[model samples]
Target: MKQDHRVVRRTAAALAAGALAAGALAGCSSKNQVPSIGYGVDAVIASYNGGSTLGANSGAAAVFSRVLTGFFYTGPDGQPVADTDSGTAKEVPGDAQTIQYRLSPEGVYSDGVQTSCDDLVLVWAAHSGRFTKAGPGGPVPLFDAASTDGYRDIERVDCQPGSKDATVVFRPGKHYSAWKTLFNAAELMPAHVIAAQVKIPNVVTPVQTGDQPTLERIADFWNNGWKLAPGKVDLTLLPSSGPYRIDSFGDKDGLVLVKNEKWWGDQPRTPRIVVWDGHSDLKSKVSDKSVGVLDVGAGSLGDVNLGGFRRQNLPGRGVEQLVLGTGGVFGSADARRAFALCVPRQALFDKFGHPDYNVKLGLGAGPLNSRTVQQDSVYYQAISGAGDKYKGGDATASQAAASSGMQNQTVRVGYLEPDEQHTAMVAAIGDACRAAGITVIDAGAPDFTASQLTDGKVDAILGGTAGMPGPSGSLNATDAIASLRTGAGLNFGRFGNGRYDAIADQLAAEDNSGTVLNLLTEQENLLWSEMPSIPLFAAPRTIGFGDGMENGVAGPTKEGAGWNMDRWVLKR
Candidate 1:
């Protein structure tokens, strides 16, 4: 939902006052003394390409937000803010479906190559799902893109040879409201470098010619070439267009980023940033002055004892839920509903949700009621009441419902290993489901990946769905379509519903807010009735800022504290 402008102004004023009191308002006058600050992240970075399927983790997103500049970024008020320094996007007159993008004249990669139309075309081709190769079974997508929601609607991208501008045209009758999110810098790899790697004259030739073989070769490199490891990094392929570039990387020492000398924008306020894993002894490191900022889970706030650190609770863009598979113990809708009835959603929230954190932030201190919208959003509708029969661990009703081929059935719950929050949630589910004669097995794995959802290794998954709101401040229906529609890329639960998909598509294309709210109500009702997933509390994130660390605020999006890292100021 659209945040009140008054709240945004108040928050800004308070932060500015705090910065002045801490002497952090001095605008880099002491340039000779470069300040190096440590930033602890919650996950390990696997790749620099956060837009790829293999690199869709928070660690990669945090780093890429600093190393790459784009046309727009999520602002402090949770709305898109245009970045004129990188580029500008404008809609063509009388053509709502066409957008023209022009890169800044001074835009150049760290390797001194001018940013051009090649970069734009590369991102479009990779995400459009236009290129494919024959697999053992059939044709498979050449590029392993994370999600091709808005990009797949593009009719074509028009660009002049060697020009720094491009025109994107969507297919007739297809209008994407979230067009601003397309072609983020993190998705724009250096096309010149990829062309050299594939021994091609340029990337535009194959894309323009539709040469399948050449396109396949380029796709193969894009899929596997940019992966990051602990100690191994290829500098030639990792050029930065933003303010920073990777200087060093290690599993133990963490990743280091230094200012990009070739950057054309204003210099970054912080010269060097050291990123550490939050799973390590971050509290001790903060006390010892080894770490200066922390992005941690709200559940761990109780253990933090940093006296001078400023802690802020940021509402996450996702909701933790229990997703059921289509086969095995949860095959039937009745069985899935029974399992949802037995789940201790309240218990799980009490254990890990940190209600006090939300209450202090002026939000409801209870389990989330809607899957599509956050609790505090103005458009949120409390549809969970329709499933009141499943509230507060309804063992009797669950037992009665589980008697039909569901009694004594065992279901494995999969989650990422070493996650205290998920582990505790799984244990609670087991304890509550016991009364219904259902067995909940903990299938935690160290190397668990999203592939498990399709492999059927686990009957259900304890995970979350990203909850990005639309421009109107309501949960974007297109985002819901990506996760719940039949055969959607992010539909890990193998859920399929033609009716739900139709309503979601209509909601995405409709600009009328009243009609959207009605559609959302219908969508939530279907989700609760079908039990594809059980909605839990809204996920909570906390940011801890050490002394002299200014402008390091937590964003509501997945980027978290690193959303504005380029503007962060450190006073020693």
Candidate 2:
């Protein structure tokens, strides 16, 4: 679940203009005269390849969930379910480390090409962390993959030239518990399209032969090829394998999806779906019958008129936290602790975590204590009350600690601009830290990117720790390991502790439930003491369905409201 830190922000006026342009196109069609369903999104889609580092976001995940078909998809319960319509995955008998995948005979891409083993091999190669280039310090991955958790354990993939069947073998004693999640539709791209882009005769041969020059070329294209803009997208490079295909896209207008003519599975009930930017004027759009469904942040729920709509609040898969940098004014453990002590977690929670919202959402109303376990889970244990000291806004003890060597020190706090919750959170931090003789500066920007942390542009970032959902509706331990382990890909805070990393590793690998719970407790205690990041609250999302729609429930996973868009029916 590792993703880039850039949050998409577009003004309402800009987005409305873009939506009007897309609306004009939808009005041109009369045969399928049903009105297009308008779905709202929060971010701009820069890349459609969710497996690549650049495309790993909620915006891309929601759009691609309908445009791509694979062996498995995240179900309503937040677990991976086998998609028999696309393919079949089963473990080989007598060998727990081997799994075989066979694509459906009728599965084909939008361009009339059959979905085959070549696509699987290309996805595996890009995500396996196998292709690397020599750096001055060490080897660096050529392809910027979002996460290599399960893929790195793969030994080899066996497939013929153009077969639809592929066999995957894992390394000896390397049994990944989340093996069912590998090569999902969100991660699979068209390999033939990529091969043609790089002028390679075929994708299977280069991966099988370990052709360095050819692999490097493929990696270069994989990393930077699929990036999109409002009017600059090349449709040929973005073919669809699922029931829907991207008819048009805009940064502010969002994505317009139409039924794929080549799709062989169940046809989509709605002929067209327009994913509009949720930042626009949703109230008016819904009233004018232009927008039929709204998926927005819970904080913005007040802005929308809920009349004639069925509204439900969903507990988001991401956790909001203040990510502290490891190499700045607050680099030392003591300084980080002092800052945490001054944060008013309870007050912040009381303001944002209204009991009414929690009651409707079926969520616990409090700040989350553990980064690994959600508050509503049976395995949740409040191991550390260390954060209890920060309930009040008083910072007398924090001030005493800062007086020694860090008095009057200026700390810059960064966040994604145009965000109401994050902006208020940053302001609250400034107010609380002011009494501690610490000057907190607001450094939020509209174009803030993840590189700011590593490049020292900001000392801390108030962002969400978006993790992949596990089988039990909790955050996956593999994602926790990826975010905290030493030199791990998702370790944005650069917090490293050998003991904590070991506990996370055991938690991810352990099959026994009791052992995993104990390991999670150990990990929580360490995070509380280390103060690498302060867990604020589990972010909440709200979805509203107009009277004209049916089966528009929100998903608990990262795909948000459109996880099951193909099943939605629009009433005439």
Candidate 3:
């Protein structure tokens, strides 16, 4: 695979991104001399679902297209400027019931509006009757807004007393840190520019918290508020704070973005261009000679071979355990344990997964075969320490104690969804389980929502998970326990224990991963002893790219061109 930082992987599915480098060596092409002749994709970007953050998970959406820029920037070491650790919403836990955040003095909007505490209020207050008349999306029990926040913890946004001070706070919602989780989806928006002519006062913050907003009226008000003003917005634009911005643009599908001269940390290459042509078929449009340079993007990985292009293979995050339905079908913890023990993870890893993906993992973590998700998460460690649980059904381990101390009459295996790679591994698991005297039926694929497991018919299915990725990238035990919070997506296995929960909560709310390791190690053993979901071979992230594409790296690898859009230039 053409692994390189230029194609850094992103959240959602696959991110489409990048500007073409100028070059005309053997394979990878060079950029166009005429600005009018810049290159871009045609069909790869059929929709605009990703937005600037590339927050959504489509492999094809994120690309070199510049996200609107902010005036100031957050460097690698830039301070987060937290108000306090205590309170309902802070990253750090404290005695207070709320935590607030202020924009850095360095913050600036592309339109040049000073980013202040009010802007923070504008973005975080969507749930506090600020965004719309609809609702806040997080901390369901506390504010009836948690569920609406689209899986994040967010309570309110507020402007502080001055230009230098902006604050975002998590409310004392029923759920612990639930408000903070909701804000995970938030990005800094141009507050002054967006607010200048806002037609609706509610829009100072968003009303609907769903990834898909419900208030069309408010959306229109925000997007076209300037039409009411009938003038161009003088908002400053820059690439300094953001990864990319519009320097110039092609009439139809091409754009030129310049690295922010005011960037605080990294010095990105200058004048990145993105162009698209809908004139031909999807494949033809991307490979057309008229396109000039070949830009690296998520969508570009499907068919090309990076090895053939002499590009390096970037590393991806490790895979997580594929848990099956807990309450729905894989009812007994022992039954789950038995199934896991029967999985041939080692075999799969040697053959298809990471050659040596034997990394620590936990309840909320996935396999640590790659760098895709944070391998150092507490969740991953818990799963890893529990590795022994898979010894079930095997002669070496004692028979798993049935939740009811009886062998499961019917064991139905489930899958997370369409990762496909997981399905193949599950088949391997089923084969091993069958040998252990367990009857496992392939339940086909799962819906992304995981609702399929709730239906009585599905006993178990293939599954995948994610965890926080701090630098070390190993799973932390406390993270595993905290991950069991009601409706926490990755804990579909429904793992539990009073001590584990306490550990999980403390670890999740705090930055102490080291202290939780031993606890997680024991937790791993207990879970493995019981076998909830067999830890299969960690999923391997693979990449490929076609010829004629150069100066760009592939996704599924470190240092890929996917995120480093500015690094891309033509090779002539």
Query: What's the lDDT for all of these models?
Result: 0.69, 0.68, 0.37
Q: Put down candidate 3 lDDT per residue, 226-301, tens digits, no spaces.
A: 1201122222322223445445433333444555554433444435555442222323443454444333322222
Q: Each prediction's Cα RMSD?
A: 4.3, 7.4, 10.3
Off by over 4 Å in 1: 1-34, 135-138, 278-284, 300-304, 358-365, 382-392, 400-404, 466-481
TM-scores for every candidate against the unseen true structure: 0.88, 0.86, 0.55
As for TM-score, the candidate ahead, 1 or 2, is 1
Candidate 1 per-residue lDDT over residues 1-572, each given as its tens digit: 33322244336536755532223546646534338888875654677876676565324555676687777655544455566677888878545499999998999989998888888788888888777888897877888776677787888888875688999999888887877777764666778888889998778878988998899888888878889877899888888988899888886777888999998877888898888764455556666777777765555434557666676664565566777887777788888888887888777777776634546332335676666666666557444455556564775645555565677889898875556667777888899888888889999775665558667898887765521110111133234356676655456777889888787667656788888777777887788878787877666666667656666666545555666676666665
Choose the strongest candidate by TM-score.
1
Residue 568, candidate 1: how far off, in angstroms?
Answer: 1.9
lDDT of 2 by residue, 1-572 (tens): 32110111012112433221112233334423355788765544667887775566324666687797677765543556567778888887545489999998998999998899998898899888888889898998888776677787799999996798999998876777777778876678899888899997778999999899999999988888988667788889989998899889765555788999998887887888987653345555666666667666566434556676666665665566677877877678777777777777777777764424554222445776766566656666445354556554675646644653446777777754545656777788778777777788888765565447656888877765522211012235334445566654456677789998677546545889888777777777778778787777666666666654555555545566676777665564
RMSD of 2: 7.4
User: What's the CA RMSD of model 1 in angstroms?
Assistant: 4.3
